[model samples]
Target: MIRLYTKNAVLLAVVAAASYELAAEFGPWPALLTCAAAAAAASAAGAFLLRTSGVGRVTWRNRLAGYLIPWGWRLNRGKLWPIPVVSWAVWTAVCGAAVLLRPAPDQPALGTRAALLAAWVIDAAALVYLLGTLARATPGGRVGPIWKLVAVIAGVISASVGLYVGGQTTAALVVGGGPPVVVGGGFGLLLLFVVTVGRNTRWN
Candidate 1:
């Protein structure tokens, strides 16, 4: 669909911009290389999991298709919207805290900070829009209440710890603490997505 592509384009643009800004701290080449390696590693891990899960070939193909071709996946719009919106908000909050708490001399100019905040807001909005659209195309289903509650609690705890660490020691927050929270949030989202979409999926 034109609308889906447009939304994805917007989301990707925002992500690219955010990544570019983040990469400024490290050189672009190193950042690009790191991202490439991470992507490859993730792909390999995903492939290994799929291969070892004892699923039929068709089921494995469907799962791989869902991941590789997200637009084709049947997603419940109502359930999908909130996930990205909330995830992006939490990520932004954590990164925002780091920006705010940076040493005075290392702090970005006011204009830069404002621009970053604006970009983050746009990124979140775009992600919600895109995922929400996908959700609308697919039939809806109920995710277990337990999973929802767990996600909420995990998000809150991660945000609290990230904020506290950022305030106490920005170095530790950036170098050690921040990554785990982000990674945890990512895995949580992935699990939530699997639970929500996988349940209603009909494998060939």
Candidate 2:
């Protein structure tokens, strides 16, 4: 649909802007390389997540088929609620924390900080639209054992990395690297698991 394409386009634009801002901290060549790597990583990750989550696979398949045949692609809005909700929530929290807690001397310009905040707002809007689409697609669904296992494994790895990083940078942990890692890797994964898997539900 036009709306789906519009929302996706907006999200992509924001992501590109953010990527440029982040990568531009380095020189021109490094920025170009970073952007290229980020694009590739994002595409691969998106495909993997879509396949693993069992959502949006049909859309991609249809698009691929359209490329080979004469018929236009039928875009079925998939159950993409969790993807934007989880990813944007984690990204906003982690990035916001990093920006706020960055050392005073190394803080980004006010304009850059403002732009980042604006991007988060746009992401929030996109998330709302995706959730609405998902709700219309399906009333509800249960998380399966495989996803729960995946969540647990991801959570454990995140917590372990957070602890290790926190230990290594004890002095700057509170001010610099610590908060983002804790908020992102520690609390983010916990929140994600709880929301997706539920608190009282049995893992098995």
Candidate 3:
């Protein structure tokens, strides 16, 4: 049960974070808040699952989690931080959504796309922070520079998403406005490359 809870926490956190980012990019405040709420709920569920279960009857993840850690590290192995962290993420995501829902004045005015872009950037950053917290909380959290490097790269992705979103909204006056969807999508794809190939680089 503990193992399951751990795995569930890790899984829910990462997915929720990613979902928040994607939803922000697409727009619609209700959807973003819902995604954030689900993530927070999942984290709590994981905690509950942990509290009730014994180690012997726990999951395979518990067994493997230690192995994933470095030679001298240990996972926190509880519901406290994970649940609260997730809750905060959801809270922030909801705030971003609220800000987004305020109704943009117009494209040319100091509203509309600006609010939308701000929401996306904040949402993306929140998710990245959530993911980083989860990564650092894991059994391997204390070990390698790999996690730090990966975290840095994830930060870059957030920045890229923000820049892309801003560029998308302001493209009309910027000489050439490539579609934001295309640019954002491309940036996301590039992240996949780094996560796949660079996550294990010498620096990490």
Return the top candidate by TM-score: 3
- Which residue pairs collide, candidate 2? none
Question: For residues 1-204, what per-residue lDDT tens digits would candidate 1 score against the true structure?
Answer: 897667644544454455455556765555555544443443444445444565556566545533422331233333433332343343344344333433354554545444433433333333444444444643554535534544554554445445434543333233333434576689999899879997787866
lDDT by residue (tens digit), candidate 3, 84-174 = 4544454455445334333334424545444444445343443454555555574745545555655654554455445534644453222
Q: Please give, for residues 1-204, the per-residue lDDT of candidate 2 as tens digits.
A: 797567544554565456545544644445555555554454445545555543435666444322222111111244433443344443343333333322234454655444444433443333344444444443355435434544543444345335424443233233333334455688788888899887778879
lDDT of 3 at 94: 40
State candidate 2's TM-score: 0.26
Residue 195 error, candidate 1, Å: 30
Clashing pairs in 1: 76-135, 77-135
User: Sort by TM-score, best first: what order?
Assistant: 3, 1, 2
Full-model lDDT for every candidate: 0.46, 0.44, 0.47
TM-score of candidate 1 on Cα atoms, chains taken together: 0.27
Candidate 2 scores a C-alpha RMSD against the true structure in Å of 15.2
